[model samples]
Target: MRGEEMNFEPMMKMMSLSSIGLMIWIAAQTFTPPKEVVVYVEVPAPVVVTQVIHAPISTARPAPRPDSLCLALNIYHEARGEPLKGQVAVGQVTLNRAAVAYKGASSVCDTVFARKQFSWTHEDPRQPSGAELRPSLDLARKILAGRYIDRTHGALHYYNPHKVDAWWADSYAEVAVLGNHRFMR
Candidate 1:
């Protein structure tokens, strides 16, 4: 007995390590690296913005999306002769009015045709061609989709520089001048 190593703590520690090591070895032997497993992950479809812009716009407007028709009409009628940015600016103003229910208008159509707010609203309804409405329609969809940058910086009003200097123009802060129209907050 004296010839053998008699350190009790070291012997106990060795025994514990052997037991744990034996259990680990058994577990390691039982584990078969899982068979070639197959995993599937779902991916969403990509949105093509250009496809939406180039799509045909119909005057036979859908009921649920009348906002598009109303917004397009505003842009086409208000800034058809002006540049593209001017047209978008006009649409932005109409959107701003609709957002706050201005003049008790709860929708884009209501805002566009609000009393004498826009000159064309008081006049005869004009039928614009799809080609004429293409740009406006594209811009309108973009605006409603929350994708368009507010070129007017939240302007709710605008008037042509060459046209009448409205008596109330001095009442609000002017925001931007896109083309012919001066935008105001």
Candidate 2:
């Protein structure tokens, strides 16, 4: 018992790809925004990343495959406290941005993770994958499936009026006010 030493390095170094920190680093190094993105699933030993799939962005008015996990993450982080219609509005803005290559990003992931666009992206993304994530995912699918109404009124930009007076806000035309955000076109 006197010479017992617990090895903690293994616990400390689990998986690098599991964290959004690495993803942020990779995103920064990547200059060009892609039309699609590939996400990896971490498996047990000998199989670091098991599956690689293309993240659906946009195809038609109602996308053939409208559900993108990337889009869901944005809604979850940006409008977690917002109501159902509010969440859909936020999702619409993200889609609006991607449709027009806002901030030089074409894909949902790129637009969401764009430098300084969304505050949450710059911070730590713990990568929560559970029931708590369902609301956003469901909303993402619904909005993209052409089911939910466009509460944003085709607005391409939005911001919380109470939070900060964004300089750019003065320029865009404010279209809708839902929950805690002001949607602009």
Candidate 3:
């Protein structure tokens, strides 16, 4: 009976230890993070693969002439919201300035970008985008091509008449009052 009791006790202890070890393993598995696994499959012979590539096409318009571009930018920035005649008048002023040797500028671009000439050019020193400036560009092209009549009467300067106290306004002869701006000689 003693021998049997001893054997039974040892068997019980071993069973308890195994059960505790199993519980600990289960707890460890619960706390562990899952890992990503990738699987690969093999295809049988006689399989075909195909791929097609398409090239991109350009829809950009040709760049305008340098003088015309400068004129267009000036008109667009100066009087884009003004009437057609007003825009042409602004272009005429730019061309008139270019013709003269203002600040030693022999080209329209130099005249438009001359120091203290157009306030818009000074504000943002970047070229105007082509999409938003279609009307101004067209008018500038026409003016450069000499296709439109000069509405400013050969006026070389202009300013918004609504503003107060311009020093240069009194110096030059007021040529024409078209739209919000006053063309000056």
lDDT of 1 by residue, 147-175 (tens): 86888999999999697868899998998
Q: Write the per-residue lDDT of candidate 2 for residues 26-117, one digit (tens) a residue.
A: 54355233444333333345655554333332322343233367788889888888887788888988888888899999887788878988
Global lDDT of model 2: 0.71
What is the Cα-based TM-score of model 1?
A: 0.62
lDDT of each: 0.73, 0.71, 0.70
TM-score sort, best first: 3, 1, 2
Candidate 2 Cα outliers beyond 4 Å, as residue runs: 1-67
What TM-score, computed on C-alpha atoms, does each candidate reach? 0.62, 0.60, 0.63
Error of 1 at 136 (Å): 1.7
15-105 in candidate 3: lDDT tens per residue?
4446634643453344322332111122222435322222121233457888888898899888887887888889998988888866778
| Cα error of candidate 1 at position 40, Å | 32
Measured by TM-score, the strongest candidate is: 3
Poorest 10 consecutive residues by lDDT, candidate 2 = 1-10
Q: Candidate 1: deviation at residue 145, Å?
A: 1.4
